[model samples]
Target: MRIALNARILQAPRTGIGHYVAELSQALSCDAQLELDFFHGWGWSRQLPAAALPGYNKWTTLAKQVPGAYSLRRQLDQYRFTRGVSRHAADLYHEPSLWPLEFAGPMVMTLHDLTHVHYPQTQPRDRLAEIDRRVGPAVERARFILADSQFVANEIRQHYGVAAERIKVAPLGYAERFRPREAHALRACLAQFGLQPGGYLLCVGTLEPRKNLAQALRAHALLPEALRRRFPLLIAGMPGWRDANLAPELQKALASGAVRLLGYQPDEALAELLAGARMLLFPSLYEGFGLPVLEAMASGVPVLLTARTSLQEVAGPAGVYLEPGDDQGWCAAIQRLLGDQPEWQARRTVGLQRAQEFSWKRCASITASVYRQALE
Candidate 1:
């Protein structure tokens, strides 16, 4: 059957949803029974290679020089797809982002999280509205929906008044980049990135309000001075909006040598860093699924994640859990994880086992099944 995938998010770096689309698409393309067609918007776009596609290519160009044109270009792309989908007559169209609609065909949208729904304050009102408009239609028209986690599925059911039966829960997969590393190799990698081998508590994801990075810094500051020395907070993420005030506080923390902000870690370097870190601390306020928790566990690194939301779901028995907003809670958790080597090693073992349960190939296979279901 012919498949049209809404693969726009694959354009992102190694963040959660982006990684999901990029890896899973490559996996699905491996199946010879399926014919894959993908669409990309925004001029000057390029897709990284995914070998599974039997008959796959992109429609893009470098020249979109139309003046103040990004917005105009995006709208045009939307209209193009509105027209394109009807004529393409794809057996199914899979939208990777939330509320993936505005096309004329059997479509399936992947809702990554309920952050925008649960914490609308985390996203700009105007941007949320734009998303609401696009996704709103998709929710109503799509034959089925895909959610990265059950946490997000429930949110869709509640907010959109969509039944649970209409949505399928398919969690994202972990990358192989997250694997055990030699201590010497880990330090060598960090040295290249100007990262001290041991002076950090790592958190990887976009620097945004939902990530609760500001609160993480504050929690670290509240730690007793002696406890702070072994693990200075290290945040790795690209900057995102609705989080303007956050950067400055991170700046102050950086200036004081209390925090390290390594913006947009190159994938290989990030993999090494994940393997080398004292612990992966993810106290994000919310998530559709927690990719970092899986990454950390896969890397043989113990994790400290928020007890609430999907982090708990993703981390399962492999991680140490604490409340995201509880300053004292993070302080206590971080202290123990850093000081107790035996505890760390024990958790790492369980984490590795749990991490093994998720794989890109499985994600692809299940997604293909979802696609087939949509077609039926």
Candidate 2:
């Protein structure tokens, strides 16, 4: 089968969706029966000049200032990239993001989440409008839909009225790079960030409202002063919309240097960074599937995630779940992890075993099956 995948997400630095595209593309390409083409819509540009490739953090801010920017980009992508897809006459096109462009062949779309629909204010107004206009129609048109988790599958059917039979659940996977590494082997890189193995608390995600970073920061701030000092909070990812609207306690925590924002580390460094952390803190308000939680578990780190959206589905028995507003409860849980070695060790062991259940190869196989089903 010939498959054309929307690879536009790869133009920027990888976040959850970008990693999904990159890893899944590589795995899908390995299939003997499949001929795969990645469509990034670079628009006749031979190569992006070094200066033009801005960092992910800067790109996020730039992408928001212009209204209809995404709609315009997709139109251009349709004009330029679709011609080649037409020439190839691919059997199916897989969109790893929420929506698909106009295509004559059968289409498959991966719906990562409905965060914009549920928490509209958390998204930029223009982007939210664009998603509202495009995603629903695309869901209706798709031959088959791929969801990141069962929770997301239900959300699509309930909210968009997509038929349950047409939607397939294909959980996302962690890359080989997200595994645990020896402390000594990773010490030098960890030292660059002043992070010691099993010492600092880590939070990985864009600095967005839906990630509920403000609340996580508050909970970390409320940690006993001694614990806060010992397990400094480290945040990794680029800023998202309205990131400046932090709570007073979160602001104080940031000012006091108890919370460090290490913006958008490269994917290569993530596993080592995750391995060095004492525990992963992910109190997201909602998620399609919490990739960071799985990454942390895969790295053999105990994780504390909110029991929101699809997180519990992904975390299973490996996560310490809490309500997003439970500052006192979150702090108490952190205290136990800090003080109780036996509890930490048990969770870490369970996390590693659970992490084994997911992989990019498995995700690709299921995705491939979805493509075939779409053709039928």
Candidate 3:
């Protein structure tokens, strides 16, 4: 079958969704039966992990710089998409991000999360509304819907009233890059950031409202004076959404010398930090799939996370669950994980084994199956 994938998320320095697209696309590279064409709505200024596909095509003006995001602009940019997409004609177009927009051909969509629905304040207004207002009915445009988890599948049904049969859970997986790193090598990489191995509790994600960064920072500041000295709190990933509100709060925690804001560390350096950290503190308010939590688990690090949200479904019993917005509760959980050795080791081993069951190849195979299902 000819399959056209929406490659917009793969166009930049990959974050959560970007990494998902990159690894899954690369996993499809070895398959010969599938005619895979990536729809690059704009010029290819950025690099994707996959080698150049013989069928890949791009718009002369590039979708990134295109002015018509909603109408003529987006359509004109992806005009090639309407012209069948590949040599055999696309059996289905797969938009890997939330909504599959304006595809000329029959399509399937992967709704990664409904954070936009449940936590509207965390996203820009227009983007948030478009998902529910448009994509809900737009499900009829595609042959089927692929959700990252059963949590998200339920969410799609709850928010859109779409039938459960329309959604299938194809839970995501961690990249091969996220794994254990050598201690000395990890230490060297940390030194460049003026950080020391095993000296910090790590949290990875954009500094956005849903990530619950403000509460996490306050919790780090409020931890027992003695415990604070033992492990610094490190926040990684890029600054995104309502980040201005988080700046002053982060500054106060940083001044205490109990927190380090390492914005957007490279994936390799990030893997090392994960490898050697005391533990991962993931207090996200919501998630479709908590990739970092799994990445930490894959690297054999004990993880502290919120018991609510879709994260619980991903981390299982391996995660140390705490109340979502409780600062004192976060502090208490961090302490118990760091100060108690027996509890920490037991959770860490379980997390590592849980991580082993997830992989990109599996994600890709499932994705391919979704495309075929869309066609049938």
Compare the candidates by lDDT and give the number of the best one.
Answer: 2
Per-residue alpha-carbon lDDT of candidate 2 for residues 196-247, written as tens digits (9 for 90 to 100): 8888999998877788887778788888788888889998988776778765
Residue 275: error of model 3 in Å? 1.2
TM-score of each: 0.87, 0.94, 0.88
- Residues 1-376 of candidate 3 have per-residue lDDT tens digits of 7677778655455687777777777787667767666666653222354433333235322422444333454455456556535444666777887656666667788888877667777654444555566666676676678887888888878877887877878777887767776777786788887777777888899988888878778888888887787788888987786788887988777888888888888778888888888898888878888889989999989888887768877888898788866888888888777778899889888998998878878877887777767667
For candidate 2, which ten residues in a row score worst on lDDT? Answer: 43-52
Error of 3 at 42 (Å): 2.4
Q: For candidate 1, which ten residues in a row score worst on lDDT?
A: 55-64
| TM-score, prediction 1 | 0.87
User: Model 1, range 131-198, lDDT digits (tens) per residue?
Assistant: 66666766878777888778888888988889788888877787778898877777777776566655
Q: Pick by TM-score: which candidate is best? A: 2
Estimate every model's Cα lDDT from 0 to 1. 0.74, 0.84, 0.75
